[model samples]
Target: MQLTNRSKQVSNKEMTLAEKMYLPAIVGGLAITISHFFRKKPTIQYPEVKKYLGPIYRGHHILKRDEQGRERCTACGLCAVACPAEAISMVAAERKKGEENLYREEKYAAVYEINMLRCIFCGLCEEACPKQAVYLRHDLMVPVFQERDEVIYGKDRLVENMNDRYIRVANSEVQATPTEPSLTRAAT
Candidate 1:
């Protein structure tokens, strides 16, 4: 087998005294620096003037509730299984007879947690949820934390309040079957 040399040849011209001294290169660098000094800066005043994030931007995760104020998660473990980073974990428990008002399903998550450090914010958990119980909130971003433990979000932190604007926005997009007659009327 023969190898072909497809390389281009260049002429090696002798450098002038000024070129050899690198005076042209120095002047070129100075010209670039001076141009940048006069040019408009593309800087945002972070604290005072916030940059706007688009509507589809995914951020913090939230455990949603039904219209009746009951937890929609059935502790199916689907979210944990679907998470590529293995950031989610939950303990399942059977709902008590009197706890129907607290849980939407017979099985409920006794404990649910997500390690934010391990999460890639890919929205896989939200997509895996069949009940539409989990959502990655577009309005809220995950806050910076100093300690490792502070990044681990428990049910208390993940659960969205009924009055929360983000939760209301999320719920409005989800078409859930009305559990109550009043909710059915309101939807109509």
Candidate 2:
């Protein structure tokens, strides 16, 4: 069984004609191929056929405004603290005397920002907003083009028009319609 030479020796083992034919192996392979071919396709066609994302699915963040055009963000910094990715940043600003109609709380966000590229869309921002100012809309399936700075969505992009169906649902009140960001533009 051992060869004295370092060179390998050829085996004397012989295969049966049936083994050479490989009929069983071929049949089994064909059966597996057929089953796979007949199996349902699992690929989701996007754009034309968007997958039904859950209602709570996190996509983007938005700071909401009330019917009187008051900012819903209390500048609580809860979202900033909760974000694992550290994508959120905000500066608290004191609500001015007449600005009470523009701010829901005494402390409003003077500068609220979310680095979309850094955000994980974990919904923590939405959850952390005590004022319910942020929510992930089902329609936020827009494709993100690859570029140096294109992926970073700012307050302008995060904020949508009130006409959007998702915004309407969020408003959920007759008085809220007029003041919705999409419906009314804040004076620059």
Candidate 3:
């Protein structure tokens, strides 16, 4: 029973004396190796020079704050739910009468923690954020830690700093910092 019209074309051709010796094959491989030595070096000098990750790369998690310096996260648990690795965890707390300036909404995240060990950096938490509060910084990466406690990031480390804010602009071209001229500048 033929499965189809397909059949193997077996070559029973005899090899020449040169093909049997494999001297040409060795010479061809040597030529390739020699050519690579003359070519430009592919490795970059680490520490002194860092590779630029694309704008959409998901790195360390950050809970952003609004222009008014109020916490933007409403403690809605959306980011936690969106995290496929179950890395995000937060405890919602009601904002007090006098603490309105501290938080943007009535309900706020009192305790937010992201387990770095469990997180896959999938960027789902950033997408699920309705208030645009949670984001993964493309420039900043999560550093290696010896202790297990250091891997779990809390609100203290995740909150945005007023002096240094991570601004994600359009096109994923450039991330203009506080010192940069503009955020939406064309790739130069």
Report the Cα RMSD per candidate: 10.7, 12.4, 6.2
Candidate 1: list runs displaced more than 4 Å. 1-40, 165-188
The C-alpha local distance difference test score for the whole of candidate 2 amounts to 0.66
- In model 2, which residue pairs have backbone atoms overlapping below 3 Å? 161-182, 162-182
If the candidates were sorted by their lDDT against the true structure, best first, what order would they fall in?
A: 3, 1, 2
| Count of backbone collisions in candidate 2 | 2
For candidate 1, write residues 32-146 as lDDT tens digits: 9999999988775544444434455578889999888899999999999999999999999999889999999999999999999999999999899999999987656687799
| lDDT of predicted model 1 | 0.80
Among these predictions, the greatest TM-score belongs to 3
List the global CA lDDT of all models. Answer: 0.80, 0.66, 0.82
**Candidate 3 Cα misplacement greater than 4 A, ranges:** 1-28, 45-48, 170-188
By TM-score, rank the candidates, best first: 3, 1, 2
On the 0 to 100 scale, the lDDT of residue 127 in model 2 is 76
How high is the lDDT of residue 108 in model 2? 82
Writing each residue's lDDT as its tens digit, candidate 3 over 26-129 gives: 99999999999899986755444455556766787888999989999999999888899999999999999999889999999999999999999989998899
TM-score of each: 0.68, 0.64, 0.77
Model 3 Cα shift for residue 103 (angstroms): 0.9
